[model samples]
Target: MISETMESHKKDSPSDIKCGIITLSDSLKEKGNEGIEEDLSGQYLFERLSEKYEVSAYVLIADESDKLIQAISNMNSKGIDVIFTTGGTGLESRDITIETLVPRFDKVILGFGEEFRRKSFEKLGSGALLSRSTAGIYNKTIIFALPGSPNAVEMGLNLIYPEIGHLVKHARK
Candidate 1:
């Protein structure tokens, strides 16, 4: 089933999907006027997404629910095809990315989290179970919320980017 689906998607998925990236980390967000430090995960997202899709926006915001929610709204309003967010998917008190976005999901892609953990386990042992990475559709935009670590982001990117257009195609239908 999986192989046949992949073969089918190879020819018909939308190719012009636009993307927006968000990095959610208190430490990475700038305090007041101070310049924010580099966000490696967001950088990696840009470098990779730009290679195939038109990147429409990128923002680094603290792990605050209100702010993150607003960012998602803004991105979706901009007609973005997808939003890839990194960080705030853990047990910490400030980790609210998943909490904020889940309720807004028009359709939750349950397999993403399971597949992420399965893939992560191959590299991170049993610790991968604690990660809450997920993807979902919000209105017309698809959002992929990944962990903050660079390695985790890389794994999530590899697993999702290839199917982004396929995901978008179905969301539109």
Candidate 2:
């Protein structure tokens, strides 16, 4: 019965969902940091999401709360279906992604954070507890806050991509 419901949702879901990728990192925003290479997490997300969804915007910003909030708001106004925010999801003082976005959420997807930590614990042992990755809906836009590491980004995206269509469909309705 559950499978039937899922199949029905999949059939009704839109195929051209638009996604926005934001990488929040103080170092990445530095102008003279020559050693700082490309944003691997954002690139990975773009490549993977582009395979199934439309990537409408991509940007790298500092770890400031105002900047993050503004970016999210701008994307929401642009009618983006989903937004993937990479970086600043850890326990460090500068890791403020979750803190910045939580208040903006209309409905928090608590299961996403729980399952993310559970799966992350399997691969990263106890260190996973330090990660505060989460997902939620804000003004009809689904937002996923992920850790800075490429591995974490891959894991989080892998877990959510399968259900993103359904989530978006429901959120829009």
Candidate 3:
């Protein structure tokens, strides 16, 4: 649950967005004692969005297809306005986040991947092309799949957050 202070601050605010953050990684979820060493770009973005929009939840899970599907489905069922998933958008064999999410989306936001790669290419050159970043609507929730790296997460959030409020509002309608 989001804090009351956060909720009250967002109520009647211009940005009526509500968001959930999900981090996907294989080692992070397993390995019992190993901590998630990578910085969470989604968490940083969520904090900034919280200034005007409610943040409903933040979750971290493994790279398994089943886990990703289940977590995404669960979040959608919770009626979250938007969901940001960081990591597992690479070409690696274990990177099945996109596969698991494709069947669940109501519509694919193809431009998201195009824009994300375009922006990332400015920083990472040809490496950006390897990213499969994407976004779509699912059960009225706007779901965005971001690259695993913190820098990629930053790029995705910077581009997407501005319009998420409006997108969510429209999706609900």
lDDT winner: 2
* 71-171: candidate 2 lDDT, tens digit per residue: 98898899999999999988889988988999889999999999999999999899888879999999999999999899999999889988989899999
By lDDT, is 2 or 3 better? 2
lDDT of 1 by residue, 1-173 (tens): 36986878767998988899988877768563241347888889999999999999998888898889888899889889999999999988989999999999999999899999999999889998889999899997999999989999999989997788888888878
Estimate the TM-score for candidate 3.
0.83
Better of 2 and 3 by TM-score: 2
Q: Pick the candidate with the highest TM-score.
A: 2
lDDT of 3 by residue, 3-35 (tens): 786555445334656678888877777754343
How big is the positional error of residue 121 in model 3, measured in Å on the Cα after superposition?
A: 1.5
Candidate 1, backbone clash total: 0
CA lDDT, every model vs. true structure: 0.88, 0.90, 0.77
Clashing residue pairs in candidate 3 (N, C-alpha, C atoms within 3 angstroms): 87-148
- My TM-score estimates for the predictions, one after another, are 0.93, 0.94, 0.83
Of 1 and 2, the candidate ranking higher by lDDT: 2
TM-score result, candidate 1? 0.93
The C-alpha local distance difference test score for the whole of candidate 3 amounts to 0.77
RMSD list, candidates in order:
1.9, 1.9, 6.9
Model 1 CA deviation exceeding 4 Å by range: 31-37
